[model samples]
Target: MSIPFDRAPTATTDTQLSFDSLGAPLHEVTFVIVDLETTGTSAGKSEITEIGAVKTRGGEVLGEFQSLVKPEESVISPFVARLTGITHAMVDDAPSIRSVLPSFLEFSLGSVLVAHNAPFDIGFLRSACERLDYHWPQPTVLDTVTLSRRVVGRDEVRNHKLSTLAAHFGTEVSPDHRALSDARATGELLHRLLERFGGYGITTLEDLAAVRQAGWAKRQAKSHLAKGVPAEPGVYMFLDGTRRVLYIGKSGNMARRVRGYFNASENRGRMAEMITAAQEVSCLPCAHALEAEVREIRLIGELAPPYNRRSKNPERNSWIVLSDEEYPRLSVVRSTTALEKSSAIPLGPFRSRKSAQAVKELLDTLYPVKRCTARVTAATLAAHRPCVSSQVGQCGGPCAGVTDRQTYLSGIADLFDAMGGDFSSLRRLCTQRMTRLASEARYETAAEVRDAMRSAMSTAARAESAQALRAVPEILAHSPGPDGGLDLAVIRHGKLAAASHVRGSRAVADSSAAIRATAEWVPAPGPFPADTDSLPEETRVLSQWLQTATLITEQGAWSLPRSGANFHAQESGTVRLGDAV
Candidate 1:
């Protein structure tokens, strides 16, 4: 992908001179207004017969370059002669294009070049440079046509053509069918356009570039608000003039994400308007993206910023609850309160009903958790006929009295164990089945079973851990931090109760009381994604780290890091828990 000339000649050219001051004063910038007359429209098919340039600064012309270039085309087309008034006889005595290209390149060096229709002029020059192996410097280019389009309304000027603008501005010189005359007129037009550019804050060379950039000038006025954002994993809030949160978002690098709001690539008009309205930006640094993500979700649910459109409908969240019947059937429901009221085993805070359904379907594919929605007692089972699921062997057929209530309940307990984060037995069984299927050349079936098993494992682990954390009355834990310190956190019913950091020799002892976090701002937590996504690939790191997090219970007894929560899978010879959001 390297270009033939990514860098210019360092020894003789001014290309290496530093110009870090993209915000230099307007008078300091050198404008090399250039124009070209060619034999035809396209550089690939035509040859440059003449090049004209006028370099200026502070409304004063510093130098000028003009040349007639002879091409290999011995005769000019009648149309080209009539248009540019340059015939073959005119350029016959002129030097070849290769000889004139170097002078023009040198004249435009270390300067912002201006042309009426830049691509036409610059394309011709670039073609000559490429053909002759004369490395062209990457020069700053300004198009007068584009500048006029930005500065003058169509109602004021009929068009941005050189003749039309020259007449409209009343410049001393006018563009003719000649290179030098047209270039001089275009240069005057450049000065006129620059005079009106102040309203756009186009005081710098970069500012000049932003004028023609796609919607970039609109964002320049407010970029200072994001300058203070830190470059680390965090949550950012955009605030309006009234200090109300306009948007809440999470990113691994807060500064970078905030800066993206000012970029031209943001295609959504709503996003653009939101950025324009933003007057201040705030940041909340996090341990990692996970903490930021959870905090963002909770905050959005709490603040309900108008610009944030997703994860705002917690009322629509679904959970998988095992119905409390003699023949319990796995089901999906929508309320968090149902967990305590129904006395049924609950396993969710799924983002959507579709996700809950997918997890349920995956579980059913691996384990026959009776797909029938029927309520069953021994009498009811004996009286009713089995559904098609029973005939197809997808269900255990407890409704037809084929399997007794106790055996069916035993299966339900197994389902509970499988869903509650105890995945060792399921893994061993699925592994055996997958290996056997592969050996029998049923690769597709093996893949299906393997995928379903993995999906169920992830879902169960996520739901069970989240459920277990939520069910806990209170717990506290400490982890090592930078510089021989400890970071302490208090957990109550799944969300943080308090958090703090202690440094130096008093770290361990002071952490219990120095803790500084609260659940007041933490929105009620439940139903989080365990393993459903990736953005920039670092998303799962925090999740994997949180899986086996140790907790000190309120009763001073250790349930996790002591007795298993059963929500962990056996990997190799070790138990690994699910990733959290």
Candidate 2:
């Protein structure tokens, strides 16, 4: 989820550009430091027992509101009673939440709400408002915990808990879980955070809001590294002083994105560390976002940058392949090198082992293929006994000579057909299993079966898409660019050969000619383009984009397969994979 900071207002008039953009000054803004003692941690299940708030402006205390609220629908748990020192006897004569909430709302009107852990307190208040049918005045909220992390380094405190922060800042009041004392401590901590932020140019609420979501001083200190970066759609590489690439990323606006890393918007801790180590920014301007994305994937796959988490190990992608034995069984393999030497039909280039295993499990459950690992040949059938899977009817009894070689081969052919594109067999079996599971009220297991079926279909669809693209020798496609022009790409085989952006209708023809002339030469790929330098991920990326693109020209066959993954059903929530096109 993105940060919930109040954004700077857009200037509506020429005179509103300068001082108005800064927002309300910190000292001038009315802030309500609030705290609540609750029955339990869960806002949905708990009730607030006490409320305390301090209204202040310009370092002067305006007023303090404190109340012991009687619970309407809940009793104070023994643990909470001891923690907050608020027993049932103490709040028995106190007012209920329904009466006290309205007054609290009136007291905190038109002010920024401040709390140590704002979510916990705000969640309880919102839940109360919802339960009591009161219109919640949605006030701007600030969490001192979030703000403290941005300005206060770890050297000063072990953690950003309320007690830790209050002690670190040497506040006059120490938090002891009582609502009023905690509120006072939180108010003091908020002032200290503001004081620390003054050197980082956080004088206004707008500045505070922008930096609240990220580390302030570290990013501000490294802001100059992004100054030389260009403003264009492209891939960027952040390098250390010795010129080693530390991180790789792609964005439409390179300058703004790079600058964001040095600002309060980029909150990722790893990214903050990368920015600190980065001394130089290198850019590779692309024709458009598509080219930038494709280039980024290839670079990450090749360079294996330490900072990039994904697309770095394309070679480690696993695939589910059927064994070439007489009684074929499903197995997951990483190297497609072995499949080249055997007649085993490969079903996937699945990104994760778990996905490939899920598909394998689904196929194993659907078909009566052999589940045992023992190589059951005609010569060894006399010595083999039926395995547990065969006894349970999950596998054909090929080892006990119950299933003949021709029959087993026929079943293997059907399995191969299902893996190729036809999902009828798997779909029929999965539907039955799901129905049975649903009847038994095992909805989670049914959902898992549903997901596995979807994954199987998706794997088949991906393979077919790649095969169709590789079959086509050449394809030139164009889409309406973001800048009101044409974005054209030259695809050879299944790989992106070249990309170009034409700014006007008149330049389309000339740009196309130049792009085609300068395009990389890609030979006719075989059944699979696994040997190609580009990752299969790149082809998958192009496949998604080409679904919406207009084909200006093409050579050889270029069409979506008749059968594809249909996870969505037009008629009902339950997927009828058998009816999928």
Candidate 3:
């Protein structure tokens, strides 16, 4: 026979009822081990089929409460029924959750709640409490699963399951799988775990809770420190309080390397500047440290994070092209133009003007071309004032009207063709020059031509190789962020390499801002531009690296191309006075 309850009674409506029965406490501090058999995993769609509790004190069972709940849901799954042995027919006449919850709460008074995977049970209970318009006071819930993991050393136990724990402690558990039976078994398991690990500073319930809460973080930090992240590696990301990925980087020993960011006195100032801007740290732990280098390069090309040093301006992100007009004048144009006009004939989308000019000089040295800014026009030639290039014989005196327009155009066309993926033209020219020089016994000239040919071939080959690099995963482009400007930086191993800055329109920006406000950014693959032969080595390397590296951005889905540099222009419009422009 069950013990009679002695607690104040409460009035109830047709849908609400109360039960007040107190169970005995366990240990110096009492606990109520509780379990619930639910209709389904989803608390919203399902209802509790059974509720069970066992209260104990000083290693002795004081009292127990069990009830079958008639759920509002019309049907329960066969699997749930079999697992709990609580069929719909059996619970058809049973009390409702609203009628049973109060009774359970009364029995659980003056006791800390304990269960295996406490969140699973507590989550359902909390949901029910919410539906009943009751603010369930947050209880000091203990999880037997976590306690077992802590007590039985995470690695030593193949499984910390209830049955396994019971077997391990040689404690007999009857009527297993039922709510009341499981609750009793859990109570026993907790007793054994507490006794075993109690000597190792797990004496108090609060101490155990703290240990469990910090379990994963402590374990990971220890592992990272012990392994000693190497210095010869690639990139890393520094995340902050908001879990916002604040920075991406490449370095060997990323852990030891990143310590510098936090170790200095200046760290607080720098971190304070970025912390409110971030939350939750994460990284791509690479095997080969150099993989970090490669990853860093890929990341910069892709994400274009704000903190990276690369230019965020789209207009500045351009390439040098040799124009197709007569005399083949060199021109600086946006990288986006190269994607639109296939015949612009590019030399580079180099990181800087200096790098682009250096490449131009190298090309000029290998293949003789006019380097002067002087225009070779009919009027200028007729005037007979030989341009500086003509005086130096570098221009073939075209400005002196010595060359026809047809010839000038042809020469310009040939120059562009040779530079634009026509390795054979350059190769043929180099070979012819080498042959002529060799025939003249000018071996040095022949050697120079051969070396130039080799470099040109290598440059061509690299470009072709870059073309073969695969497109990034489609899901990557869907990263969550507001339509406000987003800057992504790609770091490989540990070096800053590539970056992209994206701006969304007001409409799109508004949606993205809403997502950001809620802090619901889900990582997605972003568009990674491909490396073209016309792009400089640094840009190419950065582009390829960005393809593989981690991306961090605010929330929005704006389509961008996978190759060549291009930035979306924010549509021009005037804001009205009420718009806070």
lDDT of 3 by residue, 412-511 (tens): 5656665555544555565677788899999986776665454434443343333332222111212222223333342321122222223433333343
| TM-score versus the correct structure, for each prediction | 0.58, 0.68, 0.35
**Candidate closer to the true structure by TM-score (higher is better), 2 or 3:** 2
* TM-score for candidate 2: 0.68
User: Could you tell me which residue pairs clash in candidate 1?
Assistant: 349-527, 421-566, 421-567, 422-566, 498-517, 499-516, 499-517
Ranking by lDDT: 2, 1, 3
Task: Give the Å shift of residue 188 in candidate 1.
Answer: 3.7
Candidate 2 lDDT by residue in tens digits, 407-500? 8777667677776666777777789999999999999999999998777776666666677777788888888876677778888877888888
Evaluated with lDDT, which candidate comes out highest? 2
Instruction: Judge candidate 2 against the unseen true structure and give its global Cα lDDT, from 0 to 1.
Output: 0.78
Backbone clash pairs in model 3 (N, Cα, C under 3 Å; residues 3+ apart or in different chains), count: 78
Comparing 1 with 2 on lDDT, the higher-scoring candidate is 2
> Which residue runs of candidate 1 sit more than 4 Å off their true CA positions?
1-76, 86-144, 177-187, 205-208, 211-267, 272-299, 310-328, 338-352, 405-581
